[model samples]
Target: MSAGTQRMRAAVWYGAKDVRIAEMDIPAAGRGEVLIEVAFSGICGSDLHEYADGPHAIPVAEPHPASGARAPLVLGHEFCGTVVELGPSVTGLTRGDRVAVEPNYRCGRCPRCRAGEYNICRHFGFAGLMGNGGMAEYAAVPAYMAHRLPENVSLEQAALFEPASVALHALRRAGTTPGTVMVVGLGPVGLLTVRLAAEREVPRIVAVDVSPARLHRASALGATDLIDARLGEGVGERIRELTGGEGVDVAFEVVGSESTLRTCLDATRRGGRVVLVGLAQEMSLDSFALVNNEQSIIASVGYRDTYPELIRLVAERGLDLTPLVTSTIALDTLVPDGFEALLDGPGDQIKILVDLAARSDRLGSPEASAGTRRVRPQPGGGEPETSE
Candidate 1:
């Protein structure tokens, strides 16, 4: 059914430790953009960071150059939705199509964009981070940023495209293929990394985490071994034991803590790569060890050109990542049941999906349904307008 209203319920981030479920005017499909009715959105570590100790990526003091949106912005980046309306000049997509948003908007004039490394675009900004995010009933996104979801992929599974792409890109950036690998921190990214590692033909995957639940999930995802971080400081020694004292071929540090980075470096053999996927402010590393071992520390940022590959993996490679999802809640329950629950670090919850279409009696307010206005498509000679 077509979306008949213009108002949407969004989880807006006002400040640190503050996210309110508020009703706002639905954004229209601008030139070369598509109006999407969000189906499922996954809460990310970045979102949690914004909630806990933020103003990190979310523009608070000033409006983002690309989005022109400031704080009180909608917050969610990992999401999949159905195309409800198409803006001018959009091609290869139609209304009712299921899609996963890449979310990042880049300045094509940048050197990085010209080099096909738009992930690091100098003026880079994300949908939910700077502008209209997916934690809402609807979002408007650039057509170029949307990837068509495969027939076999569910919206729930598609919501993982962003994180899975990050995992894949990190592995690709580290240039490690089939080998014994170690993934430190079995959170959503780490768990997904384990699965992607298996898909890449990595023979052995050692997963380390403090949560038994997350470690169990890693094992279920084909991790050859699991380590409980609480077990002590001998994690590297244990990994060496598992790899017969040679250590893993490559280690991915997903936790971004100094201790975890140390563990990853110690567990890796000479000349092996340590891929840092997580973001942390400070880390103290042993420079001598890194230099002497000829180990390269590769820092991975957001993904670039990974959506198509991820979609193909889900559709054809028999990759079953549905186990990563722990809960599915409606928009109203997002604060208590979604964000707060995740912040509490419930050991069992890996990924939580917010189903926008789910009805909630608690979502009743005069303003809740207030911002509805129909937008007429721009008239032209059937030509798509060009917009940056």
Candidate 2:
């Protein structure tokens, strides 16, 4: 069948709080691309940002330098699917291959791209935010971005590779080795960071969050210590108490807020490293404290070439990420049961997956809908904030 003649259901984003489930023509794979029959697509934290206060990364006025895509684009970056068609000149992959989409756009000719740092290329954007993506039944992506999955890795587990890669990259950037580490958030990325840290055999793993459920999950994932941020005691103070008033060797700030950033800085030793993994708005920093301590503040963004290591961790080393997925809803509930559920009740969710193949009735019943509940906001709450 001709690509133009086939239609698929996609979640199209027009603007903030404006996403529609429309039938869009299936996109054809261009040269060096592959058309994938999507199985599962994850609603990322970036999607939440776009849904609430948006156009942050979505191109609207002018075309993006890389993808040249504008508004009304398909919305989903974390997805896994089976290759259905291979475009001309595409190599190393055949039809029926199950793979995870990397979903990054980069200007290959740029210095950063040439230097193998394509994730930070001069003009870099995500496929879902800046262009059409896998929030649909079928998505055409660059063949190079599709990483083949092993026999042990299911498509559902593969949907989380993108965020897992982010966590892995942040750890790599921090030069995390055997030492005391503290994760300042219980979000997906934060929890993944703890899991990775535990796997790496870090001597101490301290997890901080406002939600008891997330805290307990972190402990199960290998956190040696847990701190409830909702308690009147300050996070930095609590961290110090745990570290014998010396502070952790490395602190990861995954909350992306001014207060959380400060807590990370305060919780790190004088010469320890503080890694910023979250996306934060413009906020003031204490230059005096930063310079006086002679500490280093490392910032980590989207990953680069991290899929192989993550796949090995999951496939070979038996790293299990399935526990992080708390709920799965159909595309029809992408808004109410997916996005709004996460926003209104951040503490109640970890990761919500969109089962593209499922019908609306999968979660349409009122009894099923009641599972989506909201939690009251607490000061220094341990909501599952995303660092995606």
lDDT of 2 at 334: 85
Instruction: List model 2 lDDT by residue over 1-388, tens digit each.
Output: 3545587878877778876666556888999999999999998899989987898999999988888788868899999999999999999998989999999988789899999999999998888998888888899988888999988889888999988888898899888394899998888999999998998999899999888999999999999999998863488998898889999988999988888888888889999898999888776889999999988999999999989888888899988888899999888778888888888884779999999988777344554333232122233633322111
* Candidate 2 residue spans exceeding 4 A from truth: 1-5, 362-388
Error of 1 at 52 (Å): 2.1
What clash pairs does model 1 have? 89-384
Error of 2 at 65 (Å): 1.5
What TM-score do all the candidates reach, one by one? 0.91, 0.91
How does candidate 2 fare on TM-score? Answer: 0.91
Candidate 1: regions farther than 4 A off: 1-4, 361-388
* Lowest lDDT 10-residue stretch of candidate 2: 370-379
